[model samples]
Target chain A: MSVNISKPSFQPYTGEKARISRAFDYLILVLALFLFIGSFHLHFALTVGDWDFWVDWKDRQWWPLVTPLMGITFPAAVQAVLWEKFRLPFGATLCVTALLIGTWVARIFAYHLWNYFPINMVLPATMLPGALVLDVILMLSNSLTVTAIFGGAAFALLFYPSNWPIFGMFHVPVEYGNGQLTVADLFGFEYIRTGMPEYLRIIERGTLRTYGQYATPLSAFCSALLCSLMYTLWWYIGKWFATVRYLNKI
Target chain B: MATTSEQLPVSLESDSKIPWYLQDLPLYLKGFGILTVIYIGLRLYQGAFAVASGLDSSEPAFEQYWMQLFYVELAVIAVFVTSVWGYLWFSRDRNLDQLSPKDEIRRYFTLTMWISIYTFAVYWAGSYFAEQDNSWHQVAIRDTPFTANHIIEFYFNFPLYIILGGSAWLYARTRLPLYAKGISLPLTLAVVGPFMILVSVGFNEWGHTFWFREEFFAAPIHWGFVIGVWFALGVGGILLQAVSRLIELLDMLEEAP
Candidate 1:
């Protein structure tokens, strides 16, 4: 909270020129704001872009585990900085919004214009309750440790269930070439991936073979435990970032 | 009103002790220029490599191109890392306890510039090219260690971050006394975390080989990378340490009470 890092206090403008200058500054500020947030969006999408890209990868076992594991990092970092530095609690919202914008940009430029992939296939799943829960927990507790433990669990556990509504359509069973196929599996067959053959996919292989419907929940639970750990470690990261010092050497 | 470089809105003066270039030349511009060259070069390299490798969608034609590029990038990265790191260690300040506050402030500017470049580099690596993987991988088959996506994203973009992050961390350790206090934890994490993504590349290569050469962005192997870049969060602490001191120094230049 040094003077420069904190917002500079400005007095009311008395002159018309000063007023015009301030207006221009606001306009420029708006532009920079979009660009900065746009970067956040791009960065956020990198975490889950692959999961959303292919139909074959959206199986019960790996998809749930992989998505939440990488997805939560952005929120954890953003929450750490915004809450600790500015006492603001909009990290969750910012994360989700940034991600939406990033994926929208991706689908628009990459899928829509370049390849003309279907929007339904390219659209990323919304975080839904998970993001909101993190913000609420942080707002209530006001302690990074508490937020990490409870908030992180909520983020992970909810990720699979929250996204189920979106991916459920693809999972619905439909008749195909030799036997029954889920819409997801059929999409994989229909789309011609010259580089990605059917043999390359590793879906529903391990616990999925043994546990059927119960596999995703197990993944979700494991995700919560790891998410809690990542959040706790990253919280210290936030506190460490707040350190402002000039040392005299080791 | 200050206008000239000599009268710049900075309180500290080196008294010709610090080099003229550090004092006169703008730090941000130096960083900006170098990063621009690297970025444009990378784009050119990727474009050319894609064509050369058959990443232009002709799956069968490009089989050998990616594997060869991967090995070459790996070798180049090894040399690049060693040379830059050796330069930093060899050129470190012999006596940190004797440096002036002015020098410290000047060094901080350089460090900030390094980070500014590092931030964008991370964006290009972790997000832009990383996301670009979806477009390319979904469109092609990934049979080798170097897929079209991996050639640009992992080999080119990821290595750029290592260079930028390593340089920034080295600059701080060699010049700043603050880092002498057992290596600033945030700074270490800032450097080490992204550096871990390099470790993750091992996981990525192994996973691709042992398992199918599939492209799933959120696979267990890939988590290390995305999380590694998330360590860029540590830049927060580095900023706090710099921005406050910078403001105080600027106030001094203004002769404010």
Candidate 2:
């Protein structure tokens, strides 16, 4: 809770420090410039699905898993710097919020405003709240091990329930051309037809065993456990990177 | 107790004689030898199994091309790492402690420059390139494990940032005395954030390999990655705040009336 410690004695920045900072600033600026230009091209390509755009090949089962894992990169790295140096507890939350904000804003602008797709069909993902909860849990616990074990587990467990309000509506059973399937199956059938056939829908309809209707909870549990294991390793790496013990001036 | 000035350097020199094995040449050579051995071993393994078997043949030509691209990427990364470390080591001044305040600031600035370059490299790989590539993948066909998106996102972007994250930690520890002393929250965030990113990558790739293809905003698989991203942004904000506080202190010192 009381993570902040007394500030260390301050020393004036030497000329070398200023010079290094300026150089760093220039490099950042240049990189930003390139990203700006490149992003536009990327945006255009994404809009039209270029040659290398294989991410569209996945179905519901895999895409959700892959995207968030990739998405966590910046937040975790940022937290390492923030929590270690400034005692900020909101690192994970803030990073997740920014990304979600950016992603959602992009979705709204591109899909909703631009009429690229309907809101109901192409709505932005809603995992940020879960992420925020995870970060808050970690902050409250203040132990990486605990965060990974418990917080990570909670993160996964909360995933389905968190989005159930929106996604659950789609879970209703529907009698279609060949058989009766959940609304989830229909939605996937309608939108993801090419790769995701009706058979891919992992729902319950009384024929299967293992509580077919409880697939959401089972999936969420697995995901959360994986996330916890991931957090444990990354926390240590984050700590390692924040180290400043080996400076030698040129 | 009387000491002779002439014998000082001679006596000190003899006492300072490092063991043969501890000498810089042997150490450098030993490291290089180990690296060489590891590299050869890995290459041999790849040739004997991956290439010798028809596993490589099973992949589509496009996937094979992308795999080659990944190798090129690895080479480029290796070059950059070697160059940066070489520059830092070669440029180090032995008499750094005696530098004046202005000189020290200049040195710090130089170090920051290096750090910025490193950051730029990371952002390009992690954010800009990765995002753009994701957009492409979301729209394209998925085939093989090393699809274009996986190549950029999981292989290139994730590892690059992990390295950058490590570099940030190393930078803070080496340059800033404040960081060198003990753990600081911002510093911890900086270091820990990247590691989480790396771990999150495994989940991400696994999700792609096994599950659905379409990008779902509400999937449990994505929650971990999103959390990590948010943490990284938070770290950035905290770093800015810390720097601002430092600036304010410096300004007050300058204007002391």
Candidate 3:
């Protein structure tokens, strides 16, 4: 159903109008940078907290599954507004990059400097490659369906490999005290945390570990299936929040 | 009858060098500078004292270093909220109906600055300090609710950001014509939703009482904050509302040279 408006079409502004608009854009740029860093990081920290924070918690099962699942949420919601309204496809990259900056700073100052934990123990994982791909798919396809299915899968699938380089050395096996533990597990033993309780560590449980070699891919695929659904759900959620409705009262 | 020069809109006759759209830029920058110092100062205080006297709550030094700061934070929050909100409310424009398009446009710019500053406060409270809470908890045992980080984070930082967010909402409601006439849903959702994060502190602290320490960061007990921060996405709608109104206002003005 096509609809036509009698009002004159809006045209590109020049001179003072352009300057005012550009200035507003800068203000928005600054606002959005902080907004995503603060809000998305909060959400990521609380939901994907242990997995992203500790190297030992970055296991074959939960870390691969939970990280991408939580990571895609803000990017999808942001893409809904930014891509749908302004035609800006950088929403995923913007959110991911902001999250990285927030995580890195916290890891250095909060974890390493203040608490004196080693940097490697608290290093944050990167989702940049996946975020880049998500933005690209949405920009090229311009279909929420295609983006959700393809972009969402790519986001989950690329998370592990992208982060592997930063975390791989920690996964190297070492023999100590009649038990073999990865270097990451050694960090957990060396550092005493309130979260160091045996029951609290929810990593690599169930029969999935028996599949040792195939476990990560299996988790990633499970996350891929979940993320596609999450991306679509959040897209609508983003649209709903972006509503321009005015209420007469509370 | 001919129109007199005195009858022209004040915006049209302004001789001031500052652009009408950016008149609030100095105040905005000042607000940012002040907040940065406060956050950094708090961080420094934690560095110096958190490990020394903050480890034990029963000691007199804990009362001095930590509890005193908590009490002061509560006082500052009370005074700051009352003064800022009261000033915004009492000094509200009573003649919004008579607001010129140019003046209305300028108010929108100011409103954006208020929101920008609010988000800046959120960056400190939500990203930097919020994660630091985990770092602090991981190392330091939870003896009291008013631990060093909690004193700075829960008491000071969270409330400071809430005040700024509320101020942004109040500023828009009192000064802008559309906001004064009808409450903007997006604006309300964006402001009120994050405000709930402050409310969820009760739940969070209560849960911590059971364990006396953080067991897992992603546990169900901490989900309250995650849910609350999602409402920040309402900013998308606020943008749409502002842009649509700005377009109409800008169209009413003559093209600049």
Candidate 4:
């Protein structure tokens, strides 16, 4: 006559439920991986796709502004959830992996679809170190405020140095037209994009005489300021995303 | 369906020292079923369109079909949005207190699945095709928004996620007790964040129109779209609450049988 099940100490999820749980973990991991790859593509395409495509758009003035601004939200928000939920700081690494995977996906198709634009021309520069810096800062400091200030600055400050290995050779001097041009500018010119006219390029039109040698450092500093604020904003946004409270049952 | 005869395996609900969690088998299966169908549908849609258009940006049929397809997509999206919202309004449960815990868990499972679908659509539409948009835009002269890339990326792809988000919201609002009385804040965020990306398309167009006409993904004007991505961070919040409730249900089920 009793409807209620009685209690004893043993595992109920031993065979079938354990199998189901393992399946569930696999399912969730696949879903999470798909999300990671797709989000990077989505975020990077809208935020930095243009600068990434053409070296001409990689100006000291704007690249710093756009890259870090676009990049910080992801790591900050990811760090928020990871740190809050699991005490993990792998957000930056996850983001970097996602971005690299996204670029590889894009580059594969671009190589075939767009008259085989050379891999060197279309492959995106890596930002893995920036993401690592963001994660390491959070782990070491264990303070969002400190992470936002110092970690954010490091995230911005580190981008150029990290990516420079792949792109530094391109920044080398080359003789083109009337004066000196970096090999990057020459590569962009040689690619022959029919849609992208030479005039449409929004590169720094002014001479190095106008910019002085300190242009890169100044740009990195300003980007640090911009990225710190962005990191703080997104860090709070991440906290909001990490919310687990609910209203009353009814 | 545990009975006392089945050695009284510790009931997750009644046992004083027992934990309250079971990884409900039924609910998990149902959610998985729903997400799989949606993913299959997405692949079909993408495949069929790719076959139809040949993905050539400059072919005459490409432009002609894409422009018309854009209009058709707008209409389809409009219909979906209104119908789901209207359905939720009519289907609102009057008896919130008596709602079954089993059904509530099922609703949460469905909610999570829809959100998963939303994320899946985001993968195909936002990240996959969106990046592809960058690749092809540099290849083709973009005279209008109805280019092959925009057709796949903006018109067709972006709206796919919007519809998914809308469905998740509708499911929660109509069925889940937490969302029954009014909107749940995290749920609203989960819904609104991606919808705003659809809204920001206008800003994206305006910016691309006036100033930055390149495929620069990290342009400042493009910053708004990332905000939409940040909103997707709500998935974390939503999962936390839903899993907590699931654990509670597991406890109930553990004791019930």
Name the top TM-score candidate.
Answer: 3
DockQ score for candidate 3: 0.78
Between the candidate structures 2 and 4, which one is better when assessed by DockQ? 4
lDDT of model 1 at position B8: 58
Candidate 4, which segments miss by more than 4 Å at Cα?
Answer: A1-31, A56-65, A110-112, A176-179, A204-214, A241-250, B1-103, B206-224, B253-257
- Model 2 regions lying over 4 Å from their true place: A1-81, A105-119, A181-210, A245-250, B1-257
Name the 10 consecutive residues with the lowest summed lDDT in model 2 chain A. Answer: A48-57
Collision pairs in model 3 = A242-B237
RMSD of each: 8.4, 15.0, 4.3, 8.7
**lDDT (0 to 1) per candidate:** 0.65, 0.48, 0.92, 0.68
Tens-place lDDT digits, model 3, residues B149-171: 98988888888989999999999
From the highest TM-score down, the ranking of the candidates is 3, 4, 1, 2
Superposition-based RMSD of candidate 1 using all C-alpha atoms, in angstroms? 8.4
Fraction of native contacts in model 4?
Answer: 0.52
Between candidates 1 and 2, the DockQ winner:
1
Task: Provide all candidates' interface root-mean-square deviations.
Answer: 6.4, 10.7, 0.9, 4.2
Q: Can you write out model 1's per-residue Cα lDDT over A19-74, one digit (the tens) per residue?
A: 33343334323322332343444445545555666655777777777676666766
Cα deviation of B133, candidate 2, in Å = 4.1
Q: Could you say which candidate leads in DockQ? A: 3
